[model samples]
Each structure stands twice: as C-alpha cells, then as structure tokens.
Target: MLPNLDDIAPNMAGLTIFSILHAAPGFSQIPTQDESKLRTMFIAPFGRSCYAHVPVGICLGPEYFQTKMTECLKGREGCEAVMITQSSTKRH
Candidate 1:
C-alpha cells in the first residue's frame, strides 16, 4: 500500500512519487558493472508499461551523465520508446 503524502507534507506533498534513476556523480563514477546493477534493480523489473506511464525526469548533472543515463534506458528491451524529459530550475 502507498503511504499518505498528507502525513508527510499536509499541503505540498504529491500523492505519488515517481522514480528517476540517475548516476550518483557523473558517467565516470558509474562503472558498467554498477550501471547494469541499477538497470536490473530499477528498470528491468518495471519493464515498458510502467516506465511509459511514469515520465522519466533528467535534470542537473554533468552532460555526459545525463546522456549516458538516457542512452541506457533507451536501449532497454521494452523501453526503446520511453519518453525522457529534461528540466532546469534554481532555488534560493
């Protein structure tokens, strides 16, 4: 069952949280072995249907890391048509 967002943030919390897997630092920090492990854990199980329904957000980070993550997910067996969204923002 899903947790109640109202309990966490009465006015601002979203009801559901989407997962966006990203490299910790950059592409260099994510070795092939680690990338494969992440894929097996996050992407592989959900497959295409789930991923397609939940948009993947890629924002902030090294250009190479963002590129690599996009490429990896795009290459997944049932994720070839997955949609990727890019975002940018500043906080004070």
Candidate 2:
C-alpha cells in the first residue's frame, strides 16, 4: 500500500501527489535484458500522466527491486525527475 502522505505530513495539504500501485503479477519480474520491452510495458500505461507535468516520480514496491526499476526509468523521455521509493518506511 502507498503511504498516506497527508497523515504523515499534514503540512503537505496543497501538494499534488500521484501514486501508482504495482499489484499486477510479474510486474516486477520482467527481465532486465528486455529493457526496451520493459519500458514499453511500464511507460505506456502511465505515459500521459507522467508527461502531462514535470517533476514526476515513479515509486516502486520492495526496496530491493528499486535498483532495476530505476535503471529502466532513467533516460526515458518525461522521466527526468523520476524518483523511486520503496513501499516502506525503513531507510534504504
């Protein structure tokens, strides 16, 4: 589940945050060798929203998987400000 930013930081009431849940099976199982395919599959779904505005960050679940996802998102158009976050409170 995504963190309730409002509950954690009440001062962020005016901020606009977008949260994408990766609940689909094998969503994180895509092979690193198929980066193009991975980009196609992942970005297509959220391309419009991500590109609609700047300063977009893509948060992935499970801290360990973030490294791979970060590489995938980096260099992609409109993802210049992409920030990856693990779905937990513990610091990585």
Candidate 3:
C-alpha cells in the first residue's frame, strides 16, 4: 500500500520538519542492462526512438526509488525523524 502521511503526522508533533524535493528525480541513472526493458517505440512519420532512462509510468520505478532512498538513510543519525516514499522525503 502507498504510505499514509497521516500515520506519521503524530510523530512530528512539536518538532520542526523539513521536506526537500528534487526536480525530475530518479530516472536517468538506469543500469545499461535494464535500459532496453524500459524502452518504447514511436510510430510516427520519421522513425522510432527509445528511452535511455526509466519512464515515470514504469510499474517498479517508485518502489525502486524508495528502496534506494531507504538504503541511503539506513544508520544515519535522526533517520527515525525522516520519512521517505515514492514521491517525497521529509526530515525533522
């Protein structure tokens, strides 16, 4: 299930929280072996093209990004004050 922001709201009571957003986050860094799997064809008058990066509509993009963020936050101090999901990350 998608994470519920309300469930974590109580934990932030009386604490200053900050949220950071990265523009166009988590797509271009795809591994070479996996790029082909994320490709799509264009049926136009000219020719066809494919994506070199993962598209936002790909089924596993969000989950993969979340997993990477989780790994990155592991063992860091005040990590418990942080909440991460496919769309955003909040810190307090």
C-alpha local distance difference test of each model: 0.42, 0.41, 0.57
- The runs of at least 3 residues in candidate 2 whose Cα sits more than 4 Å from the true structure, single-residue gaps closed, are 1-6, 9-11, 26-29, 32-92
Residue-wise lDDT of candidate 1 within 16-92, one digit each (tens)?
43334444534435444443344433445657322211123323235546576677777564442332332322210
Off by over 4 Å in 1: 1-22, 27-61, 75-92
Clashes of each: 0, 0, 0
Q: Which runs in model 3 stand beyond 4 Å of their true positions?
A: 1-24, 31-35, 77-92
TM-score against native, each model:
0.21, 0.22, 0.43
All models, RMSD in angstroms: 16.9, 14.9, 8.5
Residue range with the least summed lDDT across 10 consecutive positions in model 1: 49-58
The TM-score between candidate 2 and the true structure equals 0.22
State the lDDT of candidate 2 residue by residue for 5-88, as single tens digits. Answer: 566566544445534545233234543333333333334555632222111122332443555556667776444333334434
Give per-residue lDDT, candidate 2, residue 4: 59
Answer with 1 or 3, whichever has the higher TM-score: 3
| Model 3 residue 89 distance off true place after TM-score fit, in angstroms | 27
